[model samples]
Target: MSERNYRAAIIGTGAIAHAHARALQDAAGRVSLVAVADVDAGRAGEFAAGYGRARAYGSAEELLRAEELDFVHLCTPPRLHAPLAVTCLEAGVTALVEKPPTLSLAEFDTLIEAERRTGAYVATVLQHRFGPGAVRLRRLQEAGELGRTLLATCATQWYRDEAYYAVPWRGTWESEGGGPTMGHGIHQFDLLLSVLGPWSEITAVAGRQARSVETEDVSMALVTFENGALAAVVNSVVSPRQTSELRFDCERGTVEVEHLYGYTDDDWTVTPAPGHEDVQALWVKDRSEESSGHASWLAAVLDALDQGQAPPVTTADARRTMEFIAALYASAFTGERVRSGQITADSPFAQRMDGTGARWRNA
Candidate 1:
C-alpha cells in the first residue's frame, strides 16, 4: 500500500453520511469515497452523485457482497453497528463506525470476537478527543498543572422533536439503543472517559420525560472512576437550547470547557495554582492540522493504516464505552451499583435492556 489512493465505502446515507463523505474528499489523495450504500436506493444514488467518484448500493449487504473496499465507514443506526461491522470485517474490510457500537454488551463481545478472528481494524468515531482544546487539557493534566482532578461531570442539553424520532428505528431499544445516552451522550461521554480514564462503578436512572420514543429522553448517572474521582452525567433531549460542557475540579485549579461539540475560541478556562503560569505557555506551539473531529480521526486512521498499525480508537475502546452505558442502564433499572467492567458477555444486561416493559416515545 504505497501512496496509492485508499478506496472507501460508506454504508448509510443519513445526515452523518455527508460528514464522512466530506472528510474522505478532504483526504482526496490519501483516501477516496469509492462507494455509497443505503436501504434507500434514491438516497444512496443522491449521496454518490453529490460526492464524486462513488458507486451506489441498495443495502450494506449488497455493498459488502460487491465491493472490495479498503475501509468502510458505517453511519447506520446504533442497532445495526454490530452486524454491519462484523459483516465488513468478515469480508476483510476495516470499519470506521459511529459511536455506541451496538445495542448491548453481548453484541459488542461478538463483534470483538469477529475482529479477533478476522484481524479487522474496527474503530469507533470518537473524534472529539482530537480537538486542540482537549489535547491541551490532557497535557495540562499530565503536567500536574491541574493536579488531582477529583470530580468531573458533563452536561448535554439538546432538543430533538417528534419529527426527529420519526425516522424508522430512531428511538427504539432495539434500534437506536437508548436515546440520548447512547446516541447523544455517547460523544461527550467518550471524551469524559478519555480524560478521566476508566470508571469503577456507575448508578443511573433514565426516563421518557419528553418526546414520544421507545427509550428514555432524560437520564442521570453517578460514576466512580478508577482514580477515585467522582462524576455526574446528565443528558436530555428535552431542552429548548443546546449546551455541552465538561468541568474538572482539581486540587490546584479548575478547568472548564464549553461547547456544543467542538473547540471554540472561548472553549476553555484554566485557573492554575499560584505559580503555574508556565502551563498556559504550552498552548503557543502550533499543530500542523486543524482539530475538527471527523477529519482528524479520518487522518489518523489513514496514517495508521499506511504505517501498518492499529487505529487509535479500536474495538477494545468501543467495548469499554459500551460497558459504561450498560452499567448505567443496569444501575438505573436494578437500583444497585453496577461495576464498569462487569457488563461482559455473561452479564444479564448483555442480552436485553432492562426497560423491556416500557416503550420509547415514538415507538
Candidate 2:
C-alpha cells in the first residue's frame, strides 16, 4: 500500500451513506474522501461538508466524471446497484456496493460483463464476513477445532412501521427487489453462506402476512450445504420483537452470536461439548476485536486495492449468496426444491423474483 492517501468518493447520501462517511473518517490517514453525491443537491453538499472537504455533486454520474478516484462506495437502493457499479467499473474505478448486490442473477451478470471488459474490480458490501467473531469461527473450523459443521440456524426478525415502507422504494419487487430476505436478513444470511461455503439445495416458503407490500414480508428455508451440513433460515419484517441471531452446532459444541443490527465480542458465546472443552479456550485466545460494520469492510477493501488484488465479497462469491436468495424465492413461489444452479439466466425467477409474477403484483 502507498504511504500517500488513496482518494475515495461516496455515492448516495442516504442513511447508509452516513455510515460510509463515518467509516472513511474512521480510516483516518489511510484514505482521503474526495467527493460525495446524491440526487438531492442539499444532502450531497451537507454530507460532503460534514465528512471531509470533499466536493459534492448532484448525481453519481457527475461525481464519477469529475473525480480521479481509486474507488467508490455505492450506498444506493438495490435497483441502482448494478448500473451504478457498472458505471464505476467502466470508468476504471472499483466499486464497493451494498449486499444483495443486484435484483437478480441476470442483473449481476451485467456488472460481471462490465468488470471483465473494464479490468476494474467490483466488491459487494457483505460486511458480516469481515467481522472478528465470524472470522474466529471460520479459522477454528478450518483447523479442525470446531470439528465439522453439523447444524446451523440464521434468523433475522425485525419490525418496520408503515412510514418505513412509505419510502418510494421500500418493499417493491421492481425497486427494492425482495423484502426481509433481500434487504434486511441479507447481512446475516450472507454471513451464513460465508461460514458454510457453497449451498446445494433449498426448500422454502415466503408470504406477505402483515405488511401491505408487493413482496413477501416473511420467509423460511431449509438449506443444504455442500459439506453435508444443514441449516434452517428465516427472514421476517413483521415481528414485534426484533433480533438477529446465528447459531452453529459443530462436532465439538455450539457457537452462537446474538445481536440486533451489529455485534461485538460480548454478543458471541462458545460452548464446548463434555469432552471438547479445549475448543472454548481456543475461541478466547486471539482474534480481531473490531465489530463487523462499514469501517471493517472499508479497511479490507482499501487494503485489497492497495495490494492490487480483488477485494472481499467479490462478485462470484456474492453470486452464491444471491443465488441462494433466488432459489429460496423460486422454491417458495413454485412449490419445488430449488437447486443451487436452478435459477439460471433463462429462469423466469431470475428475471423477476416471483417466477410466475403472480403474488404481490399489487403489493
lDDT of 2 by residue, 1-363 (tens): 657687999898889888888888899899989999889999999988897699999999988888999889999888999999999998999999986689887898888889899999999998888888988889888888888999999999999978899999888889988889889999999999999989999999998898888888999999999999999999998998999999999999899999998888778999998999998889988855688888888888878877888998898988888888889999998889988788889998888777776465654
Per-residue lDDT tens digits for candidate 1, residues 1-363, read 559688899999988888888888888899888899999999899999999869999988888888778999999878788889999999999988887778877887888889889988788888887777777778877886677889888988888999988898888887777779888988888888888988898988888887877778888999999888999998899998898888888777677778886664367776655676654555445333465468877888888898888786887777788888878788877778988667666667877555333333335
Best by lDDT: 2
Looking at model 1, residue 125 earns an lDDT score of 89
Alpha-carbon runs more than 4 Å astray in model 1: 284-289, 355-363
lDDT of each: 0.82, 0.89
- The candidate that wins on TM-score is 2
Query: Which whole-number lDDT from 0 to 100 does residue 290 have in model 2?
Result: 86
Scanning candidate 2 in windows of ten residues, the lowest lDDT window is 354-363
What is residue 251's positional error in candidate 2, in angstroms? 0.5
